[model samples]
Target: MGADGGTASALEQALSTYLAHLRVERGLSANTLAAYRRDLERYLAHLVASGRRRAEDVTAEDLSAFVTNLRTGDDGGRPLSPASTARSVAAVRGFHRFCSAEDGTPDPAVDLRGPSQARRLPKAISTSEVERLLDASSIGDGAVPLRDRALLELLYSTGARISEAVNLSVDDVDLEVGAVRLLGKGSKERVVPVGSFARRAVDAYLVRARPELAARGRGTPRIFLNTRGAPLSRQSAWAVLRVAAERAGLPHEISPHTLRHSFATHLLAGGADVRVVQELLGHASVTTTQIYTLVTPDTLREVYASAHPRAHD
Candidate 1:
């Protein structure tokens, strides 16, 4: 009953339409779009194999079975970890929801639930380690070092995600007011105060280093530039963090998000309210910011021991 002579072809057509919507309307990034494609392709293949040709034909039980298969790998592939399973479930659910909205079909994944995953605490570097990392960013006397230092300093100061940091324009940061405007996920913008240290570093880069770097290529307003004066890519930003971490003699692997986690954790440890940190981090919900509170359990224990009379006993 389809172009390719099977219901599977119809399902594939539906998937193509949904992916286009995500790309054009939702404005999902390429990496996110690819991930959704992989998850949903696998899911649709399972549905087709089970004779689910139409979205209206699928049931909630079928969605539940797919989740079980993902967890147990009963279909013969390697079993998915809890986190991967959750992501796949999310992709599949979103696909079904899109189909329902477009054609008014019953959403099979409406009540679907993902596996219970243990919440892992975000990894954060110590204050001393952060200092060392920042110092390492400015190891040499050159434009590159100056730019690297400013980039790292801003990352730690405002808790900007690596993408947001690299994508920043010159006008996004105001040294006079010591504030930086960050465009977050879904293009939501938030203004966060820049610390004195970061402002000084960025100031030095803007005044002394950026002019030289900006001369090599055509021209752009992006704050950070490579040697060719082009906007710095996310991979380049990641390489800067890796090189700095190695120079600082840090043992564990560190990513740009490590700085963000450190910023939130340090703020929470210093008695900053969770809501304020949420605003600084540009999180849509305070609930997302609450995870940083768990990182300071030792600090809480110390306070309880010092303040509560019966804490020691």
Candidate 2:
């Protein structure tokens, strides 16, 4: 071990054990666990660089400085986004809590509120742009054009995470009632209403395209299947969105989540209640869903500047 290895390994060993606890004990998803790993790697590196070595040595000032460092710059002196810094703080807090619980050390990060990150508004396409993207999905010449169209339509209609949508089984959909069941975070299930347009698109895909894909897998039950007849993965689903967006002449940032964001924002813009949006998005906390409520400041300012009676004569 090198001079810094002892301190570094102390943090590393704790991080690994905590991650294992999250994975096995808490049943955290693989994606979340991977994020925890990356965040903690940076955190542990910070501790080592600061010469912090012992499990019980982390002080509140040290924790505060760590977050400050994250905000100002990363180890390579590159600025991190507010969201990234916030996530790193969250990871550090979680690690300290684990250490306190297991080793009976004082947890400095326990009371630290972490950095307050401004809620970055989700990017949503206009209704017309969404229409174009959906239409573009059907333009491909493959046997799976219907499938591609259905996938995009379902994403917008259900406000589902791509992982939730791709993990769906045929049984998760109720065509007669026009709803799809999503297993969201923590395996919480919610049935979201599929609109008439989406229902029609999905029905056509099931009838025309799915059968051929299913033939290759010999009765696989996944709703969306790849060319190889395997269940559609998150990466492939994202690629599908990108391709459709490009074909429709949309911006490069039109991700699968953009459809979900559009679904939430459009619903709210049309006066759908925030609580209803919460339920539809399957958010565990309405607070998590409330970012959609933030209005565009530029739009609000423009309206106020134009409509006020005190405007320039």
Candidate 3:
């Protein structure tokens, strides 16, 4: 009930209950929960090392030490980057808050602050550039071209990560309903609406291409396949996309997340709700999707500078 109730076993039990709360009440995905667990593991290690065994026994000084430990390194010479340290500190903070709220344990991490993270704005391709990429992918006429075209279109349209696109099965796509089910990180599955362009491309690939590829691969259920007929690996998908990007004259350094980034940015620029984009992008937190909003202001400024009759040069 208080700091007087101090035991290492009590701390472990409290950590388990807090994690269960995160999973059930909070609906956090598995990967996110794993990260929380990983971060807390370090914090727990720090607690154990300092001989503070109970949630109530943790103090502001202990929380600060945990943050410092995260910044320095964990028994290893390798240092954690600022962002990684920040995430770890955040996990520790959340754990303390959970203990305080649920078990009425004192909250020592309440005033602790994680290191400031450098904001890495997502890079978004212009709409015209995306169009060029799609056109280039579909330009060549062959089974591979057809499949690549579908893949690229789907990526752009649905904002699916490459893994989601590759893991898709024939049944995951509902062309008639204009939707595609994406299996995202943490085993989360989301069904995003497919635009007409993506549907048409997918239809062409399915009708004229997928069967041929599948035949070679012993009836693999994956929607995208390599030349040898196996389910497309992330590496191969990246290579396929690189070829399309080169043909479209896109930058050589363009990442696979480009289309996904562009999708969210464009939607936000077009006045889409942040919450809607969060659902589309399969983000567990709306705050995660809020990054795209940062990309919209430049676009808004461009619109204002170019349009409005009074702003003549």
Candidate 4:
């Protein structure tokens, strides 16, 4: 096929096929697929402009130049941050791998690397702040307030991701056993111990609030439901956390994962083993869980100043 039209169409077809594979076979979420589409589209444009119509025709140098263009804004777009650039690189790499396997195209992106980024520590609120956040969720009256409180409580107590929390069925929770079954990434299941505080709050929600909310819509097995009685979406779950953070007067930007971070951090601080924390967080690797093991500068300074005999000096 010629480089002008045929090659361009081939590249576009490849991208469409790859995206369908991601959606159907890989089971990527809609948000993730959208991001991949955006990044790969940019790459396809660059390749076509450079007269490299076929995936196999591209070289490692072409891939490297594309990375530079992304970082330097040479591709008629604003400069991308390191993190965004890395995500774009990943999309391109994955696309090339798919082409190599399916079409026998050479994968020029195999050795391509994005710029390195510093690893920021997970932000964990103090226990008192956590208490304040949880309390704030319960401030208002009625079923909604009760449901909000239980959502926040369950999230903090189990270290469940917002996706996992919202996806929970009523049967997934076993209050009698003080445990919850969380389905993590790759459909893996892990049962985490529930604290008494969370168990009680969830029980209250189940007993009073859920029944009232359930009456609003068709019957469903979901544990958390919206005001309209539909199953709670990930976006709604995030909104729930955001409203709670505002009411709690928290200074930092609190996302849904903040409670999960605090849950892991506090456990490690309280002498929980790294392996145990790994299982609780449903992290496939202990190294991924080890980030929480890092001692905060504030904690380090406090320990030093108080315990060191000559700290004042």
TM-score of each: 0.90, 0.85, 0.77, 0.88
Q: Tell me the lDDT of candidate 3.
A: 0.85
lDDT of 3 by residue, 61-134 (tens): 88877667667775442468898888887888888888888878678888888888778889999999999988
Model 4 spans with C-alpha error above 4 angstroms: 1-4, 103-105, 295-313
Candidate 3: list runs displaced more than 4 Å.
1-30, 74-77, 135-142, 183-191, 218-221, 227-230, 246-249, 271-276, 283-290, 302-313
Q: Predictions ranked by TM-score, top down? A: 1, 4, 2, 3
Residue range 87-205, candidate 2, lDDT tens digits: 87888888888899998878878787755666678888889999999999899665588999999999999999999999999999998999899998767789999999999999999
> CA lDDT, every prediction?
0.91, 0.84, 0.85, 0.90
> What range of 10 consecutive residues in model 1 has the weakest lDDT sum?
1-10
TM-score of 2: 0.85
State each model's C-alpha RMSD to the native: 2.8, 4.4, 4.9, 3.9
- Output the number of the TM-score-best candidate: 1
Report model 1's TM-score to 2 decimal places. 0.90
Model 1 lDDT per residue over 121-212, tens place: 99999999999999998998889999999999999999999999999999999999999999887677899999999999999999999999
Please state the error at residue 44 of candidate 2 in Å. 2.0
